[model samples]
Target: MPALGGKIDMVPGRMHGLRVQAQREGRYRGQCAEYCGEQHARMALEVVARPPDAFDAWLAAQAGPAAAPANAQLARGQAVFLAQRCQACHAVRGVTAGGPGATLGPDLTHVGSRRTIAAGTLPTHAATLAGWVADPQAHKAGARMPATRTLDGADLRALAAWLESLQ
Candidate 1:
């Protein structure tokens, strides 16, 4: 593992496979130095900060399918996703993301399959993702992705709802 604010090559099974023991408080972040792709700086990194019970609930939700809503909001959310250029850096398997000029960010192919979002700062929930989308910098200063503040109220709800459904 790299030292705080220091760069170090990640060697698997040695210092690379290291795991940070979960703390009862605070958060963390890091950058990959392998030149994996573009927007490496924009790649979100996080760790959970909730207590055990809350973490358990969030974990369960991530492990399961997205809950369905009875309105066309989710469809509208999909449209918003495309129109907003989210496909530029992320990929959603079975979806039309990951187009040309979009090899920089982490693959969101199985975002719903992920247990945490923004690396680990927030639980993989619609509300949390919506918040992150609205203002990434507020949660993680110096984030490469600018805040997508155009979303508000129902728009945020619908987009988050649709994203959560992608699981």
Candidate 2:
């Protein structure tokens, strides 16, 4: 499909695969050309193709832990994250959630550094993070993340700030 702007295919066993040479130094969006499930249209991906130097820098950052909270607000946000048991479903390297027995949702070690969140459903930013934390279902239908209505406005702000700092 011309709208997709990339070649895509799905092999047996429901595996979608595509290989595209790095053509630019920025993010490229793609979608599954093959329908695999009810939300096939919503399944999207982003490829961050950077120059060698930039790619190396990004790789190094991703290999590191989530950046430490810079302020008391961010620190409080980290605490709220831990308190809410968000670690169980996500992994932030050098953080308690990545310690042991962390079930895989997505490795959020350097999520803030990424271009998008929720499987490329939204841009990566504090506002997006807060919205996702507050109610993931609203952004992505059938998203496994449960709503966090329990978090008050203050905690939500702090948590979003902390996550945004994890670059």
Candidate 3:
């Protein structure tokens, strides 16, 4: 494969895959060619970019369960989540977060326990989740959910912080 922007020929069966240019300045994108499933188009691609140190911290956090803060703030954050009706499409184990809703999206039962989030687009960090929560379309265009613009400032922090606490 080409390192930067040059074209590289690839054989379907002989070569597993190849990495091309980064979509963004520091991000990359690729697709699976093998037709091994029903939804080939829905397989989707990934774009990831993060500084070395920040990526390291995110990796360490993803390797383990969420480390909740020891304060009333987290409780309030939980309240905020419930009040916002995020449970409709998401599931949080040991909580009444799921119901008779369409499973059109990924489960959030162990969101904080995952390494890369958004189907492996970015590191599963509080800030990333916060940004996603604030503006889903910003990160992924044509996102199913509409942007919940009501969340801001401390509310955003609390909600993101609480969601991250769900290990």
The TM-score leader among the candidates is 2
Instruction: For model 1, give the 10-residue run with minimal summed lDDT.
Output: 1-10
Report the lDDT tens digits of candidate 1 across residue range 26-131.
Answer: 4555556576444445454545467888889867765553344446998878778778888787665545545685655566545755667765556888988798
* Tens digit of per-residue lDDT, candidate 2, span 1-167: 23335685667669776556765566666777686764565677877777899779868877877788888998999999899999988888877636454655788878888778876788999999999989888888778788999888999999998888888
In order, how many clashes per candidate? Answer: 3, 0, 0
TM-score of each: 0.58, 0.84, 0.59
RMSD value for candidate 1: 7.5
Off by over 4 Å in 2: 1-18, 97-103
Error of 3 at 122 (Å): 1.9
lDDT of each: 0.66, 0.80, 0.65
Q: 6-118 in candidate 3: lDDT tens per residue?
A: 34344645865545544444655445456644434343444455777877986775555334445788777777877888777775545444578626556665677666666
Off by over 4 Å in 1: 1-8, 11-71
lDDT of 1 at 44: 49
* lDDT at 80, model 3: 80
- Cα deviation at 22, candidate 3, in Å, is 27
